[model samples]
Target: MFTEARLYSPVTRTGDGDVTVHLSEEHPGVRDPEYRARRNAIAALALEYVPGAALPRIDYTEDEQRVWRTVSVELARKHRRYACTDILDAAARLALPTARIPQLDEVSAALAPLTGFRYVPAAGLVPLREFFGSFAERTFHSTQYIRHHSAPLYTPEPDAVHEIVGHATQLACPRFAAVYETAGAAVARLRTDAALKFLADVFWFSMEFGVVRERGEIRCYGAGLLSSYGEIEEFRGAELRPLDVRAMGTATYDITHYQPVLYCAESVTHLEDVVGEFFATIDDETPARMRARPVSPRPAAAARPRGSA
Candidate 1:
């Protein structure tokens, strides 16, 4: 199935005239011709309805600007404390470029070379299957907007704070990149909805909100925990158990409340290995029902009455 891209137009006001920034349905500044062509094809599918339609203008008031500045400062402070220095040093050693609230163009240029992944600035939420499909094809969806200080601690949906500060930094690592790509591939191969639901549980538990032990200490790794001010403390200090997928079964998390527990991994490599193995094992198993089906009563000769001595 083809994915549709949504276009957005963000506006800024000045003394002279309103300045509008358009995020084209078509991704721009992608160096690879083949990658650009693939995005263009997707865009063509998206624009069947949009057809170059201009988006509604977003006006930023003085108060909004102040809120944004304050939020940026707070985010920067958190970034300094939580960001993995080893990852940053590795990125720098590899001469990987960095950005503060990078545009899709910048992310696309950086990621496309490492993997075929390119950034798409989503207008709203995409279906889980579609999101997984994009990852299978090495495309990462991101939102263009940033969260404001008014809700510094929480946002209903992922803004640039979670996308850039939390997710993109880890994408720079090669091992983590392979893990994500493999998980996406597994998601794409599953035919049944039950299997998808099970895998999503696995993803939610590990990839989005997992932690790992390093040097005899627990540390924040998952993007969800890293981005959230409250979760970071809770995940590290609270009760955590080893993630045993087979025993625990599939489960969903409460997004609004601080997580009471988190899964711990021996190392990042071990986490990747375990996920890969779990998918392989589950792919072969038939989904078991939680409840038994009713059966009709048997004949007197074939069945014994209850409590017969």
Candidate 2:
């Protein structure tokens, strides 16, 4: 299936069970033997985390640790200036170390006590159904690999930086975790593909790219904005629309670039209320209803991918 996920994530499995996630040709690691070996080793470990087993472990190289530390420090600075209070607070509580790559078990341990969410390793491209549906059980499927070393601050794919620092930080919050749980429950009730796709769109806009108005300033809570060192600074430039679930479900935008359109909640509490209500009440008919109505004018896009995260 040529879905939006494939646009950002490397395909994980082959029919015989062997799997690999490759670096893009432009990635400097594509030509570095040691970096290639490291990626392959991590991919193998991720594949071991299928069921009834502990999450796989990785002994991160000094170079990978450097990448983690670099992003940690740089992203933290951006987060303070641009992140929403709730997200900042949760990250403080998690206290994810900045010196080394934290293991999946470590992240799961930290997140569970706070939000009942735990990290599970992923080879790559977790099925969208499994990805979103796991939220009901408070599970997060996460990739363990670091991005290619040459571009420590950049990757066109979701690395551990995006999974842990980006999504995990937000998932640790009770309110944000509740919304994800509700979303999973809603997915459980949806019987049609249209409904699921619509739900994904809503989630992408809100959970992955959402913002909030706080103290007369636009603040970011979405993981996509919180993790990217470059884009986090530029999000304020995007056109901000008030939280509108219908428009969110049908809104159009490019996934390959920084999202030029974002939905804003009045506040963090407002975020939970509006998104939570839609999740609680949405059914099979919800997508059809939203699709039947015209979304306010925007450039054409049919699918909304959670780019690199």
lDDT of 1 by residue, 5-88 (tens): 221222233465333333334223224354333333333333232322432222334533454455456644554555444344
40-98 per-residue lDDT for model 2 (tens digits): 77777777666768778898888899999999999999889999889999999999999
lDDT of each: 0.53, 0.83
Q: Look at candidate 1 and tell me the lDDT of residue 191.
A: 79
Per-candidate TM-scores read 0.65, 0.92
The prediction achieving the highest TM-score against the true structure is 2
| CA lDDT for candidate 2 | 0.83
lDDT winner? 2
